[model samples]
Each structure stands twice: as structure tokens, then as C-alpha cells.
Target chain A: DARVTQTPRHKVTEMGQEVTMRCQPILGHNTVFWYRQTMMQGLELLAYFRNRAPLDDSGMPKDRFSAEMPDATLATLKIQPSEPRDSAVYFCASGPDRGTSPLHFGNGTRLTVT
Target chain B: QQQVKQSPQSLIVQKGGISIINCAYENTAFDYFPWYQQFPGKGPALLIAIRPDVSEKKEGRFTISFNKSAKQFSLHIMDSQPGDSATYFCAASGWAGGTSYGKLTFGQGTILTVHP
Candidate 1:
């Protein structure tokens, strides 16, 4: 079965350091989504792209967090000068198209900032 | 209007029993409701989904009961087993290219422990 692949299954860094997470969506999937999961907040959509075009990123902290789809297959989420509160499991999900297919999520990158 | 509230942060059920999880949405525009199941160290997977067109949808032992008028939904797991222990989340999203389109608003989640 096809699955969304995310690199760096786990990350630990010091505060004020930069951290990057990468995801490779399933083939032929048009939509890619980035979500953050924490015990308190659960799952929150950070950003998403459709056909390589960014649709929404209102849920992300623009100051430090940035998400981009360099190509249809590659999506990256970077956090500059990370903070302790930024620790959470970041997930990448992909689907065929808007309202056409179900989103398949990756195992997620668990981030921890010291 | 984008929040989906879930009840009973945790639940315990015996094997061969029933497990119920409820969710309420504030957005009237939300037309698609899906329930996701997640085990430790894994991503959430779509278990079942339902639309407002049907009040109830059943697939094997998993069922979704939706109330359009009340803007609420519930997931029922019958004949539960120990393997069913995981975190469940109820998500709601609207279609038709609205602001909430393609964006799922998930509830806080419920931890279910099925004892054998």
C-alpha cells in the first residue's frame, strides 16, 4: 500500500535552533496537509497545498514556522529558532484531490526542544 | 464555528461490550464527518465516515449516528475487543469550496481501553 513518508521520525534540539521536517506524499495525490498533534491540543492543521499551490496556512505560527511544497512529491515544514512550546508530533497527510479522496497520514515526526 | 467538541475524554469497556463516543459541531456548513483511530506511535487512520444525507451508517461492528438537526454525531463500536484500545478522534469538515473545505477540525479525542 502507498503511504506518506516523513523523514526524521524523531528530532531533539535546543531552543533557538533550527529544525526541518520533510514529507513525501503518495504518488498522484494532489493535496498535502501538515498537522501538529499534542496531548492538550490534539490535531491542528498547520498548512496545506493543492496541486503545489499553498491554499491555507493560518494555523501555523508565521513568525517561526513555514511550510512549502517545493514540488508535487516533496513538502517541507521548517521551524527557525524553535522553542520549547513547539514540541509536538508533526504529521503529513496526502489525498487525491479536494473532496475526492480520504487523507492518508504519515507516522509523524516527533519534535522535542530543550 | 470550526470546533468539534467531544465528550468523555476516556472510556473503558469490556470485551464483547459496546463503546460509544459522541461529538458535536458548531458549524452548520460541515457536511462531512469522519472518525479516526490511532494507536501508540502511529498516525490516525480513517475508521468510518458519514454524511448528513444519512442519519445512520453501519459497517460491520462500527456505526456512525448523525443528527443533522442537532449538529451532533456519535460512533458506536459493538463487540469490542482488547485490540480496539486506542485514541479516537471525531473530525468535521465542510465541502463545496467553503472556508472550511478540505480542512478537518478534530475533537480533543477519546482514549478507549477495552479490557478482556
Candidate 2:
């Protein structure tokens, strides 16, 4: 069974520290999405990439958050000078860009910023 | 701008009973709706989905009821089981112009607990 893999399943960092989360999408998937899950906000789309190129990142905070897919297999989300409010579970999902393909998600990376 | 709204932030049902979750969307442009089931520490998995063209879709004990005119949809699980207890989310997507075809807008989510 193919699945999206995410690293650093759990991360704890002090405020102002930099946090990086990594995801390896399914081998043949062309679309990658990054979402943040919080109790107050539910799940919010942070960014997405199609064919190794970013299609949107409007939901992300440009001043501190960034998402990049350097290659098809690797996608990363980074937060510089992370704040306490950044604590949440970040999920990475991937699927085919065409039709109504369903997204396969990683287990998620839980970040706790103090 | 909460495009999608889901009711019953939490629900409790006895085993062998029916569990229903309702969701409404404000965007008429949304053409696809899907439900996801998530367990603690795990990612949300696609359970079932329906398109605006269809009024209902079912797979096994799970079913999706869609109302295009009302902009509402619901998930019904027959014979609820304890293993089914988890967080459920309703999501919608549609053609929002350039490269926005599959971008999902999720609901607030409902936590369901099944008691024996």
C-alpha cells in the first residue's frame, strides 16, 4: 500500500525557533497539499503544489511560513521564528491533479511551540 | 468567510444505532463533496463522496445524501460501532478558476463517540 510519509512526527520548540516539517508524497502523485489542523480553526489549507511547482500558498503566512517542493518526491513546510500560536498538527496530502482523485495523507507532524 | 459549516460538534450514539452528521455549504460553485474519517494521531482518510449531479451515494453501511438546491449534504452510518468513533470532516471543492479544481475547503469537523 502506498502512503505519504512525513518526518518528525512530533516536534517541540521554544518560541522564535525555526521549525521544519518534511513530507514525501506518493511516488506517482502530481499534487501536494499542506494543511494545518487546530482545535480553534479546524483544518486550514496552507499551500499546495502541482507538478513540482507551487500552485497556491495564499493561506500561509508569508512573513514566517513557506512551502517548497524542490523535487517531486520531497515537499517541505518551514516556519521561521515560530510563535506559540503556531502549535498544531500539520498534514501533508497528495493525489492526482486530474479528475476526482482522492488525496492520500501522511500521519501528520505535531508541532508544539512554547 | 466560513464557506462550509458542519453541525453537532460532538455526537454520542449507542452501538447498533444510526449516526448522522449534517453539513451545509454557502458556495454554490462547489460541485464535489467528500467526507473524511480521522482517528487520533492519524491522518483523515476519505470515507465517501458525492457530486452535485447525484442525490445520494452509498458504499456498504456508509451513505452520502446530497441536496443541490439546499446546498446541504449529510453522512449516515448505519449500525454504528465503537470502532467508528472518530472525528469526521466534510469537505467541498470545485473549479475556482486557475489550478483551483481540487483545492478542498473543509468544515469545522464533528467528533463522534459510540458507546457500547
Candidate 3:
């Protein structure tokens, strides 16, 4: 079974450092989503893409967060000047199409800032 | 801000019992509803899904009961097993044009524990 793969299963960085997480979506999947998971807020969608193009990123913090799909297989999310409050698990999910399609998720990268 | 609302932050059930979780959505434009199952440290997997055209859809031991009029849907796990224990999330999506083929809105998750 094809799976969504995320890099750096765990990450720890300083509050002012930069953090970049990568995702390799399942082959043939056309859509990708970035979400943040915290104990208090559950899961929140930060951004999403389709066919390597961004669709909606309104959920993301425009100041420091960016999501991109350089190619069909690669999707990346970057956070600059990470804050302690940014500590959470970042998840990447991909799907073929909307409507009846289902998303396949990765193990997620656990980010912790001090 | 919460377009989708899910109840029972957590649930506990014995083996062989039926496990049920419910969800309601405010967006009437939502045409597709899906339930995802997530294990610790793992990604959420699609368990079952339903469309507004139908009231129910089933796969193996999992079944989705959807009530379009009420804008509500639920998952029922028949003869639940300990292995079925996990966090379940209910989500909704609408078909969008172009690269944005689908846009999803998710609900707060519900944790289910099946005791053996």
C-alpha cells in the first residue's frame, strides 16, 4: 500500500530558529494538506494544495508559514522564527480528488520549541 | 469557528458491543462526509464515508449513518474489538473547481476504547 511519508519524525528547535518539514505524498494523489495537531486545539488545517498548486492557504499564518509543492511527489511546509507556542505535531495528508475521495496521512513530525 | 461539531470527547465500550460516535455540521453545502480512524503516532485512515444522496454506507464492521435533513452523521462499530480502539474524526468536504478539487473541514475528534 502506498503511504504518505513525512521527514524528521521528531524535531526540536529554538524559538527563533527555522523549521522545515517535508512530505512525499502517495503517487497519483493530486491534493495535499498541511495540519497542526495540538492537545488543546485538536487538529487545524494550515494549508492545502492540488496538482502542485496552492488552493487555499487562508488557514495558515501568512507572516511565517509557507506551503509548497515543488513537484507532485514533494510538499513542504516551512516555519520561520518558530515560537514556543508553535510546538505541536505537523501532519501531511494527500488524496486523489474531492467529493468521494479519501486522504492518506503521514506519521507526522513532532515539533517542539524551547 | 467550528463548522463541524462532534460530541463525546471519549468513549469506552466492551468487546462485542456496538460503538457509536455522532457528528453534526453547519454547512449545508457539504456533500460528502467521511470518518477517519487514527492510531497513536500514525496518520488518520479513512474508515467509512457517506454522501448526501444516501442515508447509509457500510464496510465490514463499520457503518456510516447519515441524516441529510438533520445535517448529522454517525459511525457505528458493530461487535467492537479492542483493536478498534482509536481516535475517530468526522469530516466534511465540498467539490470545488480546478486544482481545488476538494476542500475539507474537520471536527474535533472522539477517542474510543474497546476493552477486551
Candidate 4:
């Protein structure tokens, strides 16, 4: 399965610490999406990129959270001064075309902020 | 207007029974609807999809019924088995130039349990 690979499947950090999650999207995939999953909110789209250009990130908290795709193959999400409420599983997904296309998602990185 | 609301946060069904999940969207511009299935400890996978051109689409025991006028869609799983138990999500996206594809949105999700 030419799946999207996410690094640091699990991360544990304390409040006020910086946490970064990385994803390697499938080859030739042009669209990438970042999602956050938790029991209370369910699966929510945090941000997304079309052809490595950020399209919408209004769902994400701009104060501390940031998402970037440095290149076609690598996308990163970072949180500065992480808070306990930020604990959740973050998933990375990629699509061949527009958001209407089927998105292939990664296993997700479970973050635990104490 | 970009929200997709799903009903019955949880559901339970007996073996061989049918499980139905419904979703409604306020964005009429959404032309594509897709259903995703997710198990514990895994990312959601695309289960089935439907386009606005058709009212009903069926593949095996899974079916999607779309109502363009009502702006609603539903997923029906027939002859359900225990393996079919999982969280189901309904999503919608616009493929036309009028509405940007970035409008893709997913429903809250429904947890379905099938007892054998």
C-alpha cells in the first residue's frame, strides 16, 4: 500500500513545550490535508494544501498551531506551547486531485500533552 | 452552510439486519458525497461514494441514497455482520467552479455495532 507515512506515531510532551509532527504523502499526490480526531470533536479538518499551496486553515488555531508543506513529499504540523487540551490523534491525508477525490489517510500521530 | 450533520450518534443492530445512517448538508453546491469507515486505531477509509447525477447507488450490501432536493443522503448496510461494526462518516465536496473543492466537510460520524 503506497500509504502516507507519518512520523512519531506517538508523542508525549508537557504543557508549554513545542511539538512537531511530520507526514510523507504518497508519491504524485498533489493535495494534502491535516485532520484532528478526538472523542469530543470527532474528526475535524484542521488544514489542507492544494499543490503545496495552503488553501484554508481557518479550522486550525492560529495562535499556536501551524502547518507547512516544505516540499511535495513532506508536510509538517507544529504546535508551540502545547496545551493539555491539544492532546489527540492527528492524521495526514493526500489526494490525487481536488478535495472531491478519494483521500488516502495515514495511521495518525497520537499526541499526549500533559 | 458548509456543515454536514449526521443523526443517531450511535446505533446497534443484530446480525443479518440492516443498518442505516443519515446525513444532511446545508451546502447545496456540494455535488459529491462519500462515506468513510473507521475502526479503532485506524484512519478512516473511503467506503462508498455517490455523485449528484444519480439518486441511488448500490455496491454489494452497501448502498447510498441521495436526495438532491432535500439536500440529504443516507448509507444503508444490508445483512450486517459483526465485522461491519465501525464508525461511519458522511462527507460532501463541491467539484464545480462555483464552489471551491476546499469546501469538503465531514459529518460528526455514527458508531454502529453489529451483534452476531
Candidate 5:
């Protein structure tokens, strides 16, 4: 079965380090989304791309967080100078453009910043 | 601000019993609602969904009940099983006309534990 693949299931880095998470969306999917999950905030949408173009990144912190889709299958989220508060599970999901299509998510990349 | 709200952060039910989770949304523009089930260390998977046009939708033992006027929806699992223990999340998305269309707003998840 097709599934979204995420790399580095776990990551631990000291403060001020840069963390990068990558996702390989399902083949033929046009929409990709990046989300951060925390115990206090639940799941927050950081950004999303449609057709390899960013549709929204308003939820992302422009100063430190960046999301990009270099190609249809590759999507990445990077945090520079990561702080302890940046610790959370980052999930990447993809789906078709159809309004009702359900998002297929990757297992996630658990990041810990000390 | 949390646009979607889900209650019963955690629930416990005996096997063969019914498990219910409720969710409410403040945005009337939301036209599609879907529920997701997530197991430990796994991504949330789509369980079931309903639209404002339908009052209820069911697949096997899982059902989604939607109420447009009340701006609320619920998930009911009949004959809950031990394997059914997991986290359930309710999500809403706006229609085609709205800017947030296709961008799902997810509610805080509910962890369900079924005792066998």
C-alpha cells in the first residue's frame, strides 16, 4: 500500500542547533501539509503546499521555521536555531485536491531540543 | 484560538460496550467533518466522515453523527473492542468558496481505552 514516508523517526539536538525533517508524500498526491503536535497545543498546521507551490505558511514562524517542497514527492521542514520549545512531533500529510479527500499522514518525526 | 473543540480528553469503556466522542465547531462555514483514529507511534488514519448535508454516516461499527444547527458532531463505536483503544480526532474543513477550504482544523484528540 502507498504511504507517506518520513525520515529520522527520532531526533535529539542541543539548543541553537538546526533540525531538518523530510517527507516523501504518496505518489500522485498533489497536496502536502506540515503540522506540529504538542501536548499543550494539540496539532497545529505549520504550512501546506499544493502542486509543488506553497499555498499557506501563515501558521509557521517565519523567523525560524521554513517548509519547502523541492519537487512533487519531496517536502521538507527545517528549524534554525531550534529551541527547547520546538520539541514536538512533526507530521507530514498529503492528499488530492478534491475538497473531500482524506489526508494520509506519515508516522512523524519526533524532535527533541534541549 | 481553537476553532474545533472536543471533549472527554480520555475515556474508558468495557469491551462490547459503546464508546462515544463529541466535537463542536464554531465556524458555520465548515462543510466537511472527518474523524481520524491514531494508534501509538502511528499517524492518524481516516475512520469516517460526514457533511452538513447528511445527518449521519456509518461504516461497520463506526458512525459519525452530524448536526448542522447545533454545529456539533459525534463518533459512536458500537461493540467496542480491546483493539479499538487509540486516540480519536475530529476535524473540520471549509467549503470551496472559503479561503480555508481543504485546510483541516483539528480538535484536541480523545484517548480511548477499552477494557476487555
Candidate 6:
């Protein structure tokens, strides 16, 4: 099946540790997005990229959080010095730049900071 | 501000019963509305979607009811099965800032439990 793929499906780390989550968007898809899902806050968009260029990241914390698409098929979200409050499921989704295409998401990486 | 508001944080239904979730939006510019279903340990999947231009759309047992004037929409799962139990999120997307790239704003999801 053609779907977005994520790595490190689950992770557990102590506070102040660095965490990295990766995603592989479906081939030929031009737009990628990173989102954080939490029970209290619901789903929120962290960053969006088009053609490997970040169009908006206002929702992501600038100091410790960064999202990048090093190549067409790869996208990554990194957190340095993670905190317990940052524990949540991080999802990656991809879609076509044009048309009314709905996003196809990866299984997501569940991160727990203790 | 929360762009969209969802009702009934959760719902419990018996098998062969109908399940419904409602959502309302504040932005009239939102043209694309979609509902996503997520199971535990999985990412949300697109279940059904509707545009403001259409009042209602149905695909098999899933139906999307839209009310353009109220800026509200709802999803109805007919004859819900145990497998239908999941968390459902309603999302809206539209172009902004002179760019065609659309950003989705999601609602606080509703959890549904179907009892067999």
C-alpha cells in the first residue's frame, strides 16, 4: 500500500534528552506537514513544507523544535532537551501541492518524556 | 482562537445504532471540510470529506451533512459496528496569505465507543 512511513514508532527518554522523529512521504508528493497530537490540546499543525521549503512554522517552538525535509522523500522533526510537557504523538503527512487532495499520514511516532 | 468547535467529547452506542458527531467553524473562507478517524497507536485516516458547495454527501455507511449558512457540519455513521469505535477529528482548510498552500485547522476530537 502507498502510504507515508514513520520511524521509531515509540520512544521514551528522560527530560533534557534529544529526540528525533523521521518520516518518508510517498514518492511524487510535494507537500509535507508535521503535526503534534495530544489529548489535552488535540491536534495542532507544527510545520508545513512545500517543495522542501518551509512555508510556515509559526505553530512550532523556534528554540527547541525544528522540522526539515533534507530530500524529497524524507522529513524530520527534532527536539533538543525535551520536556515532560512535550510528550505526545507526532504525525507526518503528505499531499499533492495542487488539487483537492487530502493528506495521507504515517502511523506516527509516540514520544514519552519522563 | 479555536477555529473549529466539536461537541459531545464522547459518545457510546450499541451495535446497529447510528453515531453522530458535530462540528462548527468560525471561518467562512474554509472551503474544504474533512473528517478523520484514528485508532489507538495509529494516525488519523481520512474517512469522508465535503465541500461547502454541497449540502450533503454520502459514501456507503458514512454520510457528511453540511450547513453552509451556519458554518456547521456533521458526520453520521450508519449502523455503527464495533470496529467503528475511534477518535474522530473534523478539519477545515483554505488558502491564506496569497498562497495556494492550505493549512488545516483541526477540532478537538470526539471519542466514539461502539458496544457489541
Task: Specify the highest-DockQ model's number.
Answer: 2
Compute the interface RMSD for candidate 3: 2.0
* Tens digit per residue, CA lDDT, model 2, B15-99: 9999999999998878889999999999999999998989999999999999999899999999999999999999998876756
Candidate 4 residue runs with Cα over 4 Å from true position: B96-103
Assess each prediction's global lDDT (C-alpha) against the native: 0.93, 0.93, 0.88, 0.91, 0.91, 0.91
Evaluate residue B83 in candidate 3 and report its C-alpha lDDT on the 0 to 100 scale. 99
- Give per-candidate clash totals: 0, 0, 0, 0, 0, 0
- What lDDT score goes with residue A109 in model 6? 95
Provide the lDDT at B115 for model 4: 99
lDDT of 5: 0.91
What are the clashing pairs of model 1?
none
Q: By DockQ, highest first, what's the ranking?
A: 2, 6, 5, 1, 3, 4
Residue A113 lDDT, candidate 1, scale 0-100:
100
lDDT, residue B53, model 1: 94
TM-score of 2: 0.98
Residue pair clashes in candidate 4: none
Q: DockQ score of candidate 2?
A: 0.75
The DockQ-based CAPRI class assigned to model 1 is: medium
Tens-digit lDDT string for candidate 5 (B1-116)? 33999988999999999999999999877888999999989888999989898999999999999989989999999999999999999999876553444588999999999999
In terms of lDDT, the best-performing candidate is 2
Q: Which tens-of-lDDT digit does each residue in B1-116 have in candidate 3?
A: 33888878899999999999999998777778889899999978888888889899999999999998889999999999999999999988766444342466777899999999
Pick the winner on lDDT between candidates 3 and 6. Answer: 6
Provide the TM-score, chain A, model 5.
0.98
**Tens-digit per-residue lDDT, B80-103, candidate 4:** 999999999999888656434534
Q: Which portions of model 1 miss their true places by more than 4 Å?
A: A98-100, B96-101
Candidate 2 stretches with Cα past 4 Å from truth are: none
- What fraction of the true interface does each of the listed models get right, in terms of native contacts kept? 0.60, 0.67, 0.53, 0.53, 0.58, 0.70
User: What's the TM for model 4?
Assistant: 0.94
In model 3, state the lDDT of residue B115: 97
The candidate 5 chain A region of ten consecutive residues with least summed lDDT is: A95-104
For candidate 6, write residues B1-116 as lDDT tens digits.
43899987999999999999999999877888999999998899999999888999999999999999988999999999999999999999877554433378999999999999
| Distance from true location, Cα of B4 in model 4, Å | 1.1
